[model samples]
Target: MMLIEETTVADDALPVEAFKAHLRLGSGFGQDTVQEPVLRSFLRAAMSAIEARTGKVLMQRSFSLSLTFWRDAEAQPLPVAPVTEVTRVALVARDGVQTDVAEATYWLERDSQHPKVRAARACLPQVPTAGAVLIAFDAGYSAAWDGLPSDLQQAVLMLAAHFYEYRDDTGLSAGCMPFGVSSMIERYKILRLGMGAGQ
Candidate 1:
């Protein structure tokens, strides 16, 4: 299985000013925007780390997941949540033939932790022999940074600050995430399922 991000978070959607304030950096300076590029890179890095640890997208964006088979035939769980929509599902054969799955046959089962693409009836559409199933969807909290949950928003700021503070620390401490940041995101992390979860 492979998952690809289809869209990038827009620069304006990022909380650059908020992050600078969080870091207590001087404002109103002529070069205030000079450090923006570096700051944005750290923010992106922090967001990526947080998202990976939580299995939740903080910034709204599109994703495409491709799989050879389902872990469950009736309900295929999405990797991230909360999924806003399932844009498309299709089968692509090795010979390059494509078949779109009818939207009527499946529904998006919304869940905070385990959103899924569920068959409306008995089972989902079949994966063509020697072909792969492609699922395209949008996931995340919101398009704007302020739309994120308060805890999550604070967590991002805290983590980003940690990263900024340790920019020169190439030792083990540089790689360590603060306990508070971990605790803040712990509840958002997806719980592991049983052995049957594997395909």
Candidate 2:
């Protein structure tokens, strides 16, 4: 199975001013807006790290998940959280024929932590032999940074600040993450126990 992010959050949608305020940086010092790019990069890095750790998408974006078959015919669990909508579901056959699943056949189970695609009836439509199923959906708390949870927002700020403070350090470990950020997002991580089928 493969999951691809089809769209990303826009730069203007990020809370740059809020981040600057959190870092105690002045908005305009003289006629120059110095350090804006650096701050944005750190924020992006922090957001990426937090999302990787938590299996959560901080901003609403489009994604496409491809699979050879369903883990469960009744319901197919998605990898990301807070799925806002399922835009499309298509089945591709070995013969190169593609069929779009009817909208009435499936419905989105928008669980906060574990969103899923559930068949409206008892079972999902039959997938063709040697074919792949593609599920396209939008997932995340919101399209803008302001829509994020308070704790998550704070976590981003904290992590970004840490990155800023340690920018000149070249000895940090590859997998190092701040304790505070980890603590803030501990409850958001998706814990899986030896399971393979469902994400």
Candidate of highest TM-score: 1
TM-score of each: 0.95, 0.90
Q: Please, what are the lDDT tens digits per residue for candidate 1 over residues 1-199?
A: 8999999999888899999999889977788999898899889988999999888999999999999998789999998998999999999998968789999999999888889999998999888888899999999999998899999999988988888888887785536778999999999988776873521
Against the true structure, candidate 2 reaches a TM-score of: 0.90
CA shift of 34, model 1, Å: 0.4
What's model 2's overall lDDT? 0.87
In model 1, which regions exceed 4 Å deviation? 193-199
Q: Which numbered prediction scores highest in lDDT against the true structure?
A: 1
- lDDT, candidate 2, at 7: 91
Residue range 36-132, candidate 2, lDDT tens digits? 7888898999998999988899999999998999989999999888889999999988887778999999999988677889999999988788889
| Lowest lDDT 10-residue stretch of candidate 1 | 190-199
